[model samples]
Target: MRSSVLALLFFACASQAGVIIGGTRFVFAENKKSISVTLKNRSAQTWLISSKISSGSAWPGNDGAVRPVIPFSATPPLFALHGNSENIIRLVGSGAELAQDRETLFMLSIAAIPSGKAPPGSVQMAVRSNLKLFYRPADLPGDPARAYQALGWQRTARGLTVENNTPYFVTLFKLSINGEAIDNPGVVAPFSKRQTPWCQASSRCQLSWQSLNDYGRVMPAVVTSVYTTSQGVSSRVITSASPSR
Candidate 1:
C-alpha cells in the first residue's frame, strides 16, 4: 500500500482565503448557454444577508450602457474582464454582439464590498455577468445503454480487466503516461476479453493504464496517473483496479 508524506492541507487551513471566485465551464461556443459562478464563503462566518454581486457588467441598451445581472442564472457564466484575487469583485453578463459577426462577448467585473459588523474594512465582492455562449446540452449523449468501469492511479504497477458491459467496437486503443504518448505494450487489434487497464513505470516510478468496460460508445478507459514524494505513489483510479482474487 502507498503512504502519504506531505502535510495535509484541508479546506479549513487558516491561511486559505475567505472568498473565492470561479466558474463551472471555461470554454463554450458563442450564443450557446449561460454560465454559473461559484461563490464559496470559506470563512467561518455566514455571508452577509444583503450580499449580492455589487459590481458587474453594464448590460448594453440600444444606447450602450452596461446593465448588470445578479444572482446569475445558468452555468458556465461569462464575465466582462479578467480580474484577480478573492478581494477582487467579479461579475458576469452578456455583452453586445460583436459588430463584426454579431457574436456576444461574456463579461466579468469586480469591486470592493462592505463587510457590515464583520470587519473594519469592506470585504471582497464577487458576482457573475452572463455566459458568452448561450447554452448547450451535455455532449456525452445520454447515459450509455451499458455501464463500464474505468480505473486510474498516480504511481505503481497494476493489472487490468475488461468486461463487455454492452456491445460496440472500441477503436484506436492507445496508452499514454505523464502526457508522453506510448505504444500499447501488447500488440493486438482487439483488446483481450477482460479489457482491464494495464500499466507500470514512472517519470520517477512505474504507472498503469487499462480499459475497464465497453458499454456503448465511450472509450471508457481508466489510468493511474498521480504520484507523491512522501507517500511514494497512489492510484487515482483505484476503483478501476480489479480485485486481487
Candidate 2:
C-alpha cells in the first residue's frame, strides 16, 4: 500500500513536455511571499502552457482539500510560448495560515497544450508534468541534512517502520533489509511514519537507506543492522557527504 501510494506521488515527475522546467522541485519559504519557476519551450513548434496547483497527498482526487490552504496564484494562468523562448511563472503566497511547525508539500502540474494544427498526417501531442513544491516555515526546527540521521527505525510484525521525527522532508532513495531490497524508496513526510511489509515478524535484520539531497539529487546510502529483541535501535551513518554526479 505504501509503495503504491509513493508510486502515484512519483508519477509524471519525469513526464516529457515540450517545455522544460528550471528545477526538479519548488520551495516556498515563510519569509518570502512568492517564488518563480522558469519554463522553456524546447520544441520547434509553439505551445500553450496551462498550470494548476493541487493538493499534494498520497492520493489526490477532486474531493481532496486543495493545497497551501493559503491563498496563492500562478501568473499567466494561460499563455503561449514560441519555440526556443522561455517565460517565468510566479507563485505568490498571501499570508496563508499553515502549520508553523513543519514544511507543507504541494504539487504544481504543468500541461503543454498544443495550440496550432499538427503536421501533415501527424497527431499533436500535449505533454503533462508534475513537480514537487514545498512550503517551509521560517521557525521550523532542524535541517534536512541531519534529519535522516535522526530517523527512528523499528522492526515490526509487518516488516519495518521508519519514522521521521524531524520537521524536514526526508527522501529515501534506497531501502534494503538483510541485503534484500525493499520497495519503499520515496519521500517520507515530516513527522510521519511509514511501514513496509518486508517481514512478517520481528527479526534481526540489516537495514540501509539513501536520502535525496536539496537539489533533488540522491545522497549517499547509510547501512546499519538492528535486532528486534534489542530495546534500542542502533543506526550509523556509514557514507560520506559526497553526492552522486
Candidate with top lDDT is: 2
List residue ranges in candidate 1 displaced over 4 A.
1-16, 23-28, 48-106, 111-114, 118-245
How well is each residue in 1-245 modelled by candidate 2, as lDDT tens digits? 65555444333332353578888778888889879989988667677888877767642111233445735678877899888899989998877688789877777888887777644544455677777777888877766666776677666667666788898877666777777786646566777777756554436667777776567766666666656545554343333333344
Instruction: Compute the lDDT for candidate 1.
Output: 0.31
Q: Candidate 1, after superposition: displacement of residue 172 in Å?
A: 37
Model-by-model lDDT, in order? 0.31, 0.69
Over 4 Å off, model 2: 1-17, 59-70, 178-184, 201-204, 230-245
Estimate the TM-score of every prediction: 0.24, 0.77
* Residue 150, model 2: Cα distance from true site in angstroms: 2.0
Instruction: Estimate the TM-score for candidate 1.
Output: 0.24
Question: What is the C-alpha lDDT profile of model 1 across 1-245, one tens digit per residue?
Answer: 11121112222231244445454213223344343445555555433211233211222111132332332333222222212222223233344232222212223332223233523232233332231221112333322212223222234345333333222212223455555555633311111243324444443423333332222123444444344466554434332433211
CA lDDT for candidate 2: 0.69
